[model samples]
Target chain A: MNDNNSMAYAQSDTAQNESAQSSPVQNNSIYAQSSPVQDSPSYTNMPLLQLNDLCKRYPGMGSYMSVFHMNLIIPRGRIIGLLGPNGCGKTTLIKMINGLLTPTSGSVLINGMAPCPATKKVISYLPERTYLDNGMKVSQMVSYFADFYEDFSTEKAYGMLGALGISSDARLKTLSKGTKEKVQLILVMSRQADLFILDEPIAGVDPAARDYILRTIITNYNPGSTILLSTHLISDIENILDDVIFMKNGSLMLYTSVDSIRSQMGKSVDTYFREVYAC
Target chain B: MLGKLLKYEWRGLRFPFLVMMIVLASTTVLTCSVIYTINPNYNEAIPWYSSMALMFSIFLYYFGLIGCSIGLSLIIVIRFYNTCYTDQGYLTHTLPVTTRQILHAKLIAAFVADVLMVLAIAISLFLIIQVTLHHILSFIPEFTYADLMWEISRGIGEFEEIFGIRIGLYFAYLAIYSLIGTIANIVTLFGCVSLGQLYAKHRIIGAILAYFIVQFILQVLAYFASLPMYARMLGTSYNSDFSFFGLMSPTMNLMLFFSVALAVFMYFANMHMLTKRLNLE
Candidate 1:
C-alpha cells in the first residue's frame, strides 16, 4: 500500500514538473490527464521550448489583452497539436515562435536560446498562408530554401515532391491549392531540423490529401525532430499527435497527452474535442 | 555570404536588367545611325566637331533623363527601397540576414547597378563617336592628336594655368547633386512605406500622401533657407571675375549636406517605426 502511495505521489510530482517546464507559472490541476508522468521512467528530459506570459491584442477587442498570458512547454521528438477555432491566437502564437510576430511581453526559448538566426536555422516553419512568390517554379522555390536555410535538404525535398507526385518544374501559381499545400508540407518536412512549426497544415486540403500529408510528415521529418502543428481539424490529426493543446478564445484550455486525454475523457479525442469546444 | 545575397538580388533583377540593356543598346545604335545618315559624307572630310558635340550633348541629356526614369537602376532601387515594408517584405525580414546586412546589400547592389548603367551609357557614347565621326587621318591638319593631347597636358605643364578647373568643378558639382537626389528619393520611398505600413488599412494611400506631405514641408523650408545662401553665393560670384564654380561650390555643398542629412534622418525614422510598430496583418 505504501509503495502504491509513493508511486502515485511520484507520478503527480512528475506531471507537475512537466507542466511547470512548459510555461512558467503554469499549474496542472492534477485531476486533468497526464497524471501518470511522475511514475513514468522518462521524466527528466528538458523541454525543447517554453512559452512564458505570451499575449497579443487586436484593435477594438474591448479588453486590454487579446491573447492573455499563454504558457506552453514542448518536449523534443513529440508531435504537439495546437487546436483552436479561427481568431483563437493559434496562428499568432505560432508566428511568435517562428519570429514572424513579436510577443507583446513574453519570452520563448528554443534549445536554451532565444529566436535568433541560430534558433531559426533549427526551426523550419510552414506558414498558414502561401508565402512563396506565386510566379516561382517548384525548383526555384527549392533553390531559394536551399539558399536561406543551411539545414535544408534539396535531395530530400525533391524526393518528397516526387512522392507527392508534384513536379519540380510546375509553377506555384499553376498548381492547385491542395497541391500547393502539399508542396509546402513536403518542403517543410524535408528539413532535418530540431523543430518544425506547421500552421494549419491540412486546413484547406481534402481528407485524402490531409491523410497523405500526415503520413508524409510522420515519414519525412526526422525521428528526433519536434513538430508543433496548429489546426482546427483535430479529428483527423488526433491519431498522429503525441500531445494535444486546446485553446479557446486566446487562452489555453487544456494541455495533456493523447493517451491520458483518451483515458480521462473516456471517449475518442473527437468526442472530447466536441465536448470541450461545444458552443 | 555577400555573394549569395548579391546572387539572389541579381536573380530578382535579371529580367528587368536584361530589358533595360536591350533598350539602351538599341536606342544608342538607332540614334547614332540616324545622326550619321543625316550628316552623310561629312565623315569624308574634317567633321564639324562643335556641332556634333552639341548634338551628342543634347542626346545625352534626353538619354540621362530616360535612363534615370525607367532604367534597371531606378527600378531596382525603387523596389529595394519598397521591400522594407511591402507584403513581400515579410519574407525578406525573416531571412537569416541582419537588418543592417539587408540594407547594406540593397544599397551596394543599387550602387553597382548604377555604376553599370553609367558604364553602358559611356560605352554607347564612345561607340557612337567612333562610328559617326571622321577618321583621325582626315582631321590631321585641322586637329592633330598631338595638339589635342597637348591641350589636355597644358595644366600639368604649368600649375598656375589650371586650364580645366571650371570643367572639373562643374563635374564635381553635378555628381554631388545627383548623389544627393538619388539618396533623397530612396529615403523618401522608404519613409513612405514604413509610415504607411504602420497603419492597419489604406496603407498605400496613406504612404503616398505622407510622402507628398514630407516633400512639401521640406521644400518650404529649403526655399526659405535658399534665399540667403543664393544671395551670398551669387554676390561672391559676381565680385570674383564671374567664378561661377567658386560661388556654386558652397551652395552645392550645402544642398548636398542637407539632402544627405534628410535622407539619413528619414532612414532611421523608417527603421525605428518598422522595428517597433510594424503592423503586418
Candidate 2:
C-alpha cells in the first residue's frame, strides 16, 4: 500500500509542477504567499475563499483562543483536506467560513466578498450531524432546497434518491443513519455551487458507506468548484485530495499539496500526520 | 425570497393551527345547538339537567376559544426557537437570504396568524350569539331578523351619542391596538431568545430570564404611562368638565404609541443579535 501510494504521489507531483509552470498569474494574496502551497502556480489567481487574521476566543479562557490568528486562501477547483485531531479548531474554521459562527476578529471573504446572502448562494455545506426536520418527507426536503437555493437541481436530487432506492415519500426520521447521511449528501451535491464545504462527512460511518460517500462527492461536484473537506480519517480520503491543511491548537500547522507532502516526507499523508502530531 | 420563506413558515404551522380552529368551530356549534334546544326562560322554572347541560356547553365553548388563542401564539414562539436556534438552524442560517429578510418573514407570518386567530374567535362568537338570539326570539312570535338588526344599530347610535365618538372609529382603534400588541409580543420573545444565545451555557434558562426581565420592564413603563390619566381622573372625578373620552383617549393613544416604539426597538435588537452576535452551538 505504501509503495503504491508513493508512486501515485510521484506522478501527481510532476503533474502539479507542470500545471504550476503553465499557469500565467501568481496568487499574490497574503495567505497564498504564507501557505506552503504558494509554489504551486496552478492555484495562484482568483481564490474562492480567503481568511485574514481570523480568531475565535471563548470567555473565561483568559486569552486562550479556540482558533487563533489564521491566514489562508483556497483557490477554485481544488479538493483540499482539512485534517486535524478533535478540538483542534477544524470545526470552528468551517463554521466561520459558512457564517454559522462570528469570528472574534478578522474577516473571511468568499469570491472577494464577505460571507453574506450572495456567498451563501454559491456555497453548499453538509454539516456532520443531521440538521433536517425529521417530520418532513424526502420529497418535502427536496422542495425546500429548491425553494431556498436558486441553483438547486430537483431532477438530480430525485435521480440520486431513486438510484439509492430511497422513497421520496419516506419521512426523514425513519431512515437509517447511513441512509440519512446519504440523503443529506445528495441534497448538498445536487446544488451547482461554486464551493462545497463538507465537515467530517465520513466520520462514524461504516467503511462501505464511506467509500460510497467519497464516490458520490467526487462524481457530483462541479468540475470548476472547490471542495473543502474536513475529516479525521485521513487515510480514507487522502487519495482524492489535491491539497492538505494541517491544523493544531487553534493555529494552522501546515498547508501544502498532498503530493508534496508524500514526495518530500517520503511517506503517506496518514503516516506523516501520525509522526508530526504523535504524542 | 421573503415570500418563499413566509410560504414555508405558514406551511409548518398550518397543521396545529388548523386543528385548533376545527376544535373551536366544533365546540361553538355544539354549544349553540345545546343553547337553542334548551331555550331557557328566566321567568319559567328550568329543569336541573337542562341548566347543567347549558353550563357544560358554555364551559366547553369558552375553553376551546381561549385555548386556541393562547395555543396558537405559543406554537408560533416555539416554532421560531426550534427552527432558528436548534440544530435546524444550520439549514436556516445558511439559506441565501439576509437575516433581516428572515426576520421579516417570521414577523409577517406571525402577524397573519394573529389576525386569523382574532377573526376565528370573532366569527365563532358571532355565530353563537346569532343562533341563541334567534332561538330565544322564536317564542315571541312577532320578532324577526329585522328587529335584531334594528336593535344592534340603535345600540351603536346610543353609544356614539354618549361618548361623542363614532362606534366604528372606536373599533378601528381597538383593532390597531390589538395588532400592535401582537407584534410587540412576538418581537419581544424573539429579542429575548436572541439575547439568550449570548450565554455560553444554559441558553434556554437564559432566555426565560430575559423574557421575565422584558415583561417587568414593559409593565413598569405601562404603569408610569397610566399615572397621569389616573391622577387626572382622581382629582376631577366624573363631574369634571372634561368628558370621559377626553381623559381615556390620550392614555389609549399613548399606550399604542409606546407599543409601536417597543416593537420597532425589539425588531432591530433581534436583527443585531442574529447578524452580529450569533454564536450557535
Give the winner by DockQ: 2
Query: What is each model's TM-score for chain A?
Result: 0.83, 0.85
Write the residue-wise lDDT of candidate 2 on B72-173 in tens digits: 988887888888888888888999999988898988898898889889999999999888888888777787878988998899879866665788887887
- Displacement of residue A7 (Cα, Å) in model 2 is 33
Provide per-model DockQ scores.
Answer: 0.29, 0.65
- Candidate 1: the clashing residue pairs are A11-A38, A11-A39, A22-A72, A22-A73
Best by lDDT: 2
lDDT by residue (tens digit), candidate 1, B2-45: 66677777666666766777777877766665555443434565
Question: Candidate 2, which segments miss by more than 4 Å at Cα?
Answer: A1-45, B142-145
Question: How does the DockQ of candidate 1 come out?
Answer: 0.29
